[model samples]
Target: MNDSPGWASPGSAPSDEPDRGTEEQPTPAADADGPAAEQPSPPNWSKEQPPAGQWSSPGIPGQSGPAGGATRARAGSIPHQGGWYGQPAGGPPMWGAGWSPAPQAAKPGVIPLRPLGVGEILDGAASTMRAHWRTVLGISLIVAAVSQTLVTVVSGLWFQGTGRKAAPDGSSTPALRQAMRDMADTLAGSAVTSLIGLLATLVATGLLTMVTSRAVLGRSVTVAQAWQDARGQLLRLLGLLILYPLMIFAIAAAGLAPGIILMATGTPEAGLLLMVFGGLAATVVSVWLAVRYSLASPALMLEKQGVIASMRRSAKLVRGSWWRVLGIQLLSFVLVALVESIIQIPATLIAFVLDGQSLMDWANGTADSAGWTFLIAMGIGAVISSALTFPISAGVTALLYMDQRIRREALDLELARAAGLPGYGTDTTSAAAPGAPTDTSGDPTPGS
Candidate 1:
């Protein structure tokens, strides 16, 4: 086989020709009609056969050799005896006489410059946080704090202004009105909080993606540096963020539309059944689409691509590994959820304790507003949870993107050169490679 690292492609097995330096060499034969053709012909296979077991298999003991009947053993050579079927007597068998271990991949940063396993991807994310906490946590903290504070204020005002009271006479109509008001208030509060969180997530994801990219090359980046590097694409990222959810919503709406029409035409039972099935189908499709496009944020930030192009890039990378990608993304989500629950649950209890009367009033539908103590406590919990979990979620996504590229496109080679490893053929004076973490400016350019 030609000398190259890693496994050779199929059908390129080792050559079977004997070494040229061997003592016995076949001489070139003369023309068929020459005088040499008068020599006796070799016997046919059926006419003359050796006795059973006369010749041992190659590389086995008792095999005849050029030196006579003596057996010879070569150091580091594969033995082909037949005792344990194929295993050696003492332990596992070696590969072969010429076998050598492959070179260890270069690891200049959080991960080795090669395709990654699930554990390695997660570990790389955590390592980025540990290796560059200053930048990573700083970005998350600022975003979470600002967003949580706004959410707390909005929630307090919303609860105060929209509080509903039960009917004094125990009338069903007043109770229904109260329920409708509660629903409207809940929807308004959720929308405000969701929008705030989305903005916070956009900023944190963009900044942390840059940090994680540099960390992969064993480089450190400051908060300002990451922001500057990511600023150009933040608008495009915003567009992507908005577009993705809208797409899912549209899918769900389309699924429910027919059911709504059926109900309006007086087929309530059939309409409800159709809605159930359609909603389930729509949920499955939405989840599939979510996993398919999960890596778009990192692609947008790192590759400087427009929204649609980045999404297309994500789709291409995830095409063959959809289930694997889904598993990893789900694992990250579970981990983030666990962390949030751990932090927020205690904070919620503390908030209840701090304003037990308000909690009781809210339960009885008598409270007009959330107390400052409760709002502040809950906000602190949210801030802490978001601050810690943002880095993890963003880092995993960025690393997963890199890992896919490494597996499919040999991006590790570019990463190695970008890191300026000794033997990766990096040219010190040349411009940065395509996958290198360079500062990009201006808006993202559109592409397919």
Candidate 2:
């Protein structure tokens, strides 16, 4: 029931007659504790008007007026009363004698029902983990374990090489061919491992995005609920994941194509210069595209849109605020990187300790091979590290998408309704803050 500052109740002003110090000031006996002690009368705000140009508000006791003249009303302040406590004859005051600021929308989950700042977005992400640790961490653990195992197996099979020996044919050609074959095998194994990791990541992203959406509504969801919500559109999310990287690759190749042609035609020096500049240009464009469409996966999962539509949605949202979005995303990345390093460094050290010097020897080429123990320890470490990092990365992306929508589309009002906050949606007087736009056509919510 507290009124905002710069508003006053119907009364609480000095009396019409000049105030005599004797009545307004408390008698000395009023402070004494005895049968004869006099009690001071409380000021009757209902019958008084504050001093001219001063301010006070009902429900808020002891409000003081501005130092000089009347305070100017700020944007959201309620209008003041001019006379006695009786209600105005024409109608109710814009703010009744007893004015109160509107109640804030509740935040029972990750985010509040309002536009979010960067800190709030980060906090909401962390809160999702704290509130639903079992589901979030469990998903991450399984993905990490499976992906790490596959990576270890692939590395062992394809890249664990024996020492190179002199060519049997006594020519460098045989050695060169063998080295090239080994390189190709290594690249193939890497690609396979990467593909597996990408699939696991897509699944995790979809599931976590569902959880985050529910979390915004102060709702609890099980891993099963998350899976149910995400599975229908899982394929589309995966397609998005694949398509983005391919687009970047195509752009990069196009940029480098001219240089390659020039080099093939024996213009090596010019080709080198063109290659350097072109690669730089490609790198810049790639980053711009990446940041622009960074919200695509979340949009795809939440909006139930196709890969192309989600990408378009993200581009639209990011159109004018590209720099701000990029900065926030970059900050999230830096934070995630820091957390991953903190967790992985200790895990890697433990792996080294558990496996003695064999892992280091193999890494340094001082030994022909490493033992299974080294590989297993490293695999476990990788799993643990990935599990810890996965939720944070997923959470940041989801919340960032929500934040953008809140600013651009007034999605906060919709989220308030979805969260079942009272006095919102249809309650115009109290639905939104003063001056906030009123648009309540709901987005195609995630998990709907």
Candidate 3:
């Protein structure tokens, strides 16, 4: 084990076993293949330990140790056979033979997850959305417009033909009725539009991440620049698009089949039971998928990893954080739906008016069922909802990935280092020797 803390002062090395609270700077070394690599400068943190047996949390200031380390065992800066400042026992060793004590985490409510409320989720999402309002709304609108236009125009033509039929008198139906049904078909075909919207969203989502991260660091990038940063991962992004939907469909379909079978059984009680079971199954599946892919975009976008690599990395990062990821996702979806509802209301009302149905008439289904009018009305509503909802949905997912990193890795510091922020790790003046392996970088990770 390279006994030195990853960024500790050179002389601050553990005494025989380094003493806590001392730090020094290490000098760089020659590059292995070419020139020597330089050392990293002045240590960032001074290790602090309480009485050795009294599990000291080595985490940075302000963060608490997990539940007083009450759940399982000891909490300390002890280097376990499993790495990280943890108290891992007889399982596989993390990073390698060391325990990095975990810090207390922040949740979404009760200041963080204790007293959860739906409004907290809605308001948080709203705040996040507002922060990136330009990108969020712009991308969603673009998605809505492009997808809606294609589906509407194409279906209008397709249904126009499908609506045509010979009467018993061997005559075609009236052009107006055919036209109206064609429009309705186009409106119903919004699913196709939704798929294309997903692709547009892949782009929007990735770029939002780059831009938002920059914003977090008090920097900004033009949308075009953000797009460039996101461009390299397009293939991986598309791969995720394919894989994710298939997984969602397969699980949901599998869950739904059981419910359908139960419902088909004679007893309503059986049907209700099956529904409850099926819903639970689907919920589990969604949570599993969300956690699995929580880090995929970051892995792909920032690490320049491929689709499978990204997926594998994301899965690893979320190994112990499943429910938390699921909750965040659930909260995100619910918030998006609420936002869509607000947008849907006004559009629906306007459409109803345009279609010759008064709000009350339509609400009560008392208006004349003018086929063409109905098609146009519904079509308008779909178009509007798609435009407004698409971007924010995509943006929220990207934001979730960022939040995950922040919570798990203290990634803001890593990002700062990457950006060459003052006092950050990567600057040459403050650089660490690349080749002088303390062999400790992966210590926090277990047996990796």
lDDT of 2 by residue, 49-166 (tens): 6444333455455555457433432223433322333333344334444445544546857887656788988889889989998998888888788888888887776656544333
- All candidates' lDDT scores? 0.78, 0.73, 0.55
Q: Which should have the higher lDDT, number 2 or number 3?
A: 2
The total of clashing pairs for model 1 equals 0
Worst 10 residues of 2 by lDDT: 438-447
Cand. 1 Cα-lDDT: 0.78
Q: lDDT score, residue 116, model 1?
A: 90
Q: Give candidate 2 misplaced runs (Cα > 4 Å).
A: 1-105, 160-173, 356-367, 425-448
Model 3 residue runs over 4 Å out of place are 1-140, 159-191, 255-283, 358-391, 425-448
Candidate 2, residue 128: lDDT: 92
Candidate 3 C-alpha error for residue 97, in Å: 38
- TM-score for each predicted model, relative to the true structure: 0.78, 0.73, 0.55
Give the per-residue lDDT digits (tens) of candidate 3, residues 1-448: 4211134432244558754544785656666788767545776765785533323334334343445543323443344221344434443233322344454323321112112234543344455446656765665566556665665565555454342332335448775675676567766665665666677667666766555444443343565666666777787888887888788888887877776777787667777788788878987977678677876876677556788888987886666667766777677777668867887777667766676666676556455444454455656677677655554455455455545554555544444443454445445222222331111122110001
Error of 2 at 295 (Å): 0.4
